[model samples]
Target chain A: MPELPDPTHETYYSAAVNEALDEELARDPAVVLLGEDIGVYGGAFGVTRGLFQKYGPERLWETPISENSVVGMAVGAATLGLRPVVEIMFMDFIALTLDQILNSAGKLHYMYNGQVTVPMVLRTPGGAKGGYGPSHSQMLTNLLVGIPGIKVVAPATPAAAKALLKSAIRDPNPVVFIENKRLYPRRGPVSGPDFVQPLECAEIAAPGSDLTLIAYSAMVPLALEVKKGFAAEGGADIEVVDLVSLQPLDTDTVFESVRRTGRVLIVEEACRTGGVGAEVAARIAAECLDVLEAPVLRVAAADTPIPSSMDLEKIVLPGIPDIVRGVHELMAW
Target chain B: MEPKPIDLLLDCFRKMLLIRRFEETLSDLFERGALGGTSHFCIGQEACAVGVISAAADTDYIVSNHRGHGHLLARGLDPVRVFGELMGRTIGYCGGRGGSQHMCAMDHSFLGTNGITGGGIPVATGAAFALKYRKESRLVLAFFGDGAANQGTFHESLNIASLWKLPVLYVCENNRYGMSVPVSASTSCLPIAKRAAAYSMRGVTADGMDLLAVRRVAAECIAHVRSGAGPVLLELETYRFCGHSKNDPRVYRSREEEARWAERDCIVLLGKRLREEFGISPDRLESIRTEVDAEVEQAVAEAQAAPSGDDRCALGGVYA
Candidate 1:
């Protein structure tokens, strides 16, 4: 029998991001951190606590509340041969800087005929709740996933957060690494606390061939929990695939599982309509429709703003029950 | 501030004239359907753009605005590419992909002039920070309007630029109106440069219409920034010769005020000085004009003839 790795102490998603930033800064001179209040305040979420003390104001910069400007600054900094991990505080704030991210950060490589690459990683906390209703909370992955020239990543665990961010910072292209504000502090084992996972692969945590459960970010943890419960009680077979990177979605792994299982269930914390679930379903249908034995089932939050109440939040968000029911429904077909 | 006999002075004056005429040309063309998309002319406030670039070396960077033809020309960007960009042709700076406002020319260190207001301010600040980190002497100039002065990014960039002691020059072109809204109505301050005190930065006021004053102020700020004293702000009190854009009738301003600024026309003022004070012979001035006019026309012809890119570009840049 082999030994199982223990999950590390959970701190919350912001803490994981801050640890990764600290590790990366100590590890590489080129890696710099920029965001609003990441200085004396240690970030809005306390992820960047004491970074200003360690790295000084030169490496750890705190910019004004200008998403566009901060993003643009990140781009220019990256273009000039520095690696900048820019934090946008909240996902909704991206609306203010879409031009810099969408136009400048996302277009610099192609615009310069591949001569210039802006190696920047934009980190923002997303999801509903946490005292923020509509204005502060939003799942921006839906909008960011559709854009080209940028890699979008959402890590559900501390290990995944640290691993994926390291990879994103090293990659040649710009990356939009989203930290689900709700998933911070949750921890798991990593090959190295400073390890970097491949950004283009979906991690398959459990092995099964009956049906594939595609998920990312916070939804992946929920889907995995449901998969374990489904295997034990429902005796329903399900394969859990964590799409670590959403933009360059590792569709090959997903489709391969779909081909074997002959069914698919996608779980997303984002609203169902235009969510990453829709993207997975459309791609599977368009590319491998014949391989599917049943319709692609999706366990996603309702197409409404995330409610603040814990009870309502559970109902609105994709949870274990919703995912289990989705697996059960697919099994029946 | 007195005008200097520096060659840059005469050269910038002609460039401003060319920009005025070029924008006026675009306005005429836009009216007759010769050019497409929105047009924001730097008609009256050409000196700020012309003068600031005069302080720039080949390596320094600039982040401009939508109304950037004057800066583009002043920075020695070929008119062909500028006009080509407005017309959405491949020969443009960004291959016609970015038209009217978003023009990128790395050769001259003009990173971009974003369509969104206050978008480039942070970027310029970041570039300056990078220079300090890399130990490069290159100074970056971020040019924004009076309206952008109120933006969160404006505050963020200024704050960081001063806090980090980065080599950056913040040039604010206070042309009275941000779009149709007057500065007095949009901002709570009479002189926006007074706000520099908030960040512990040195602030100076320059007659935006006077190229030499703009150049002198910009040079001082650039030196201050390069010496590791951090960023400084220079407010060029200028006025827009045309409306907010080509379509704007500028019903916001009185004809009296418009004519008053017109009398202070930078190009007109510079040309008179070039001929009268510098004793640059009328023939030499005429020769310079003839030479620049021919070059601008050739550039226009070549840019117009340049092929166009498919505006249907589906992918973004800077990523794989």
Candidate 2:
């Protein structure tokens, strides 16, 4: 296993996004932002607080209620040499702007024979919390993942979120930077102002060899909780892998972990059908068929709309117990 | 900023004629099964593309739509490369990846055209924002069809452009139909220009078939927007002489309506105006036609002879 890198400071998940954006804005003149209520309202999740006052309206744009155009505007700005970060208020609303994101921003760089690059970041908060109901609380990362010419990043911790988002802003392609809504208040150590994560690598949050736990975004912390429980029980050494880059799968880390453990349990907050977990499981099955001691398993949200009630939500969403059960089942196999 | 000279008008005429001939040649090729897919042609709407683009500075930006060959040609994209792209050749502008609707000439400030209706409007507005933010002495012109005016993006884009005073000229080429739906049927308002008042911006309508009218109006609008007065909406009333695509059999409209629009053809209108107003001789116009025909023929020949785009590299360039 690769040695873990050291971090520098501690901050909340939302603060990580805010600090990264502030630092990027200070470092480059071309970086700008646009979204609904992001200026005075400081974003729907309060992730862009104080940026409006610091940079003013020129760089920080408070747009009208037009999701498609907001993303479209970002694509246009990116093509014309401006790096724009667009925030959709909710992940569900991203459906309105998929045409711009998929058809225009994602394809412009390639369709035009590399004549231009869409160096833009579409930042949105997904995952279920606060009883927001189906429309607002959807983990739709796979929608962006399936599209070519776009990078999809779903960081698991404050440090990972901050570093990966900065890298996403600096990347030469369009990036869908999805933040998990449930992780906004989760406090963790983040690297200092200069830290930037690689856009194509995954992080091994916990080192183990007996079994592997794979997850990303909000599910990573849940997987960690499962790892802690397994450790307390004096069971197998459960290694938890944080899949930070979702689209360009970090197969090196995944394959190595699966080969070492010979047992795998993938977890995701999104629906089970056609989720990232399914893809990761398929990759492991195809690449490490002989190495696997058991069939690859996935613990994802049930194939149903996210319920409004917390009781029903718990049943629908994958909880820490669900990950533990899956890990135990895989080990027994 | 001065009144454009006769040479500029002649240049516009040449480009408009080139686009007309280019589309005609494509029709002939498609008829013979040389080309694979259906293409949207701007047959009678040449003046809108020529007049609007001619008024724009070389540094200014222009976004086009599906029916965009005239716009691309008028923006000075090489006819040979344009033909190569339509023919899916390696020598094309986009290496044959973008057939017609998605090709872009970034060097010429011509943003790619969109197959999705009203998709490029906000992008143009964003480019306008960049231009103004960077303090560059340039603006963007986003061209969409009247059919696109119904899209929420069109209204939303205009609202933002006006609010922020972005340097964008939103030109709507109202050729009267969105596939089979006529303008009167699809549009809530007769002229798309009237809706601009809701955004608190100036809107104007002009005869899109008349080169002089389109040029005069577009020049004023371009200057106004370029000077940072904010965005302006210009709805050009025009018509398409050809069917929407290769599949149409002209069952949607009467022969009398088609004949009426053909009589007011922009290319014929400009040719007559050149002889009557500009004191150009019939022989000179005839010579210009002959020269443009030869140039287009040569471009078609070169494009047809060019190597087909490699399928091996088809998966490449999905990311930079």
On TM-score, the leading prediction is: 2
TM-score of chain A of 1: 0.92
lDDT of 2 by residue, A1-333 (tens): 233256777789999999999999999999999998999789989999999989998789998899999899999989989999999998999999999988998899888999989999999999999588889899997687788889999988888889889999999899999998899999988877787889989889899998989998998888888788878989878999988898788999999998898999989999999878889999998899999999899898899988899888899999988887888798888
| Local lDDT at A48 for model 2 | 98
lDDT, candidate 1, B1-320, per-residue tens: 54455576777877887887788777887898877778788888888998888887767988888777888888888788788878778777776666777787888888777776887787788788788889988989888899889988788778777777878888899999999999989999768898898988988888999887888888887788878888898899999978998778778889999988889988777778877887777787778777877776777678878877763442444345
In candidate 2 chain B, what residue range of length 10 has the lowest lDDT sum?
B308-317
User: Mind giving the per-residue lDDT tens digits that candidate 1 earns over A1-333?
Assistant: 012244445455566667778888888898989888999899888888989998998788777666777787888888778999988888888988787788778876765445457889998888865556767767878888777788888877777777678888888889998888767756555434545678887778677878888888877777778877877885867788888879888889888888888899988878888868899999999988988999988888787776666676766777787777888788889
The TM-scores of all predictions, comma-separated, are 0.89, 0.98
Model 2 residue A101 lDDT? 88
Model 1 residue B145 lDDT score = 91
| Candidate 2 TM-score to native | 0.98
The residue pairs found clashing in candidate 2 are none
lDDT of each: 0.80, 0.90
* Model 1: how far residue B258 lies from native, Å: 2.7
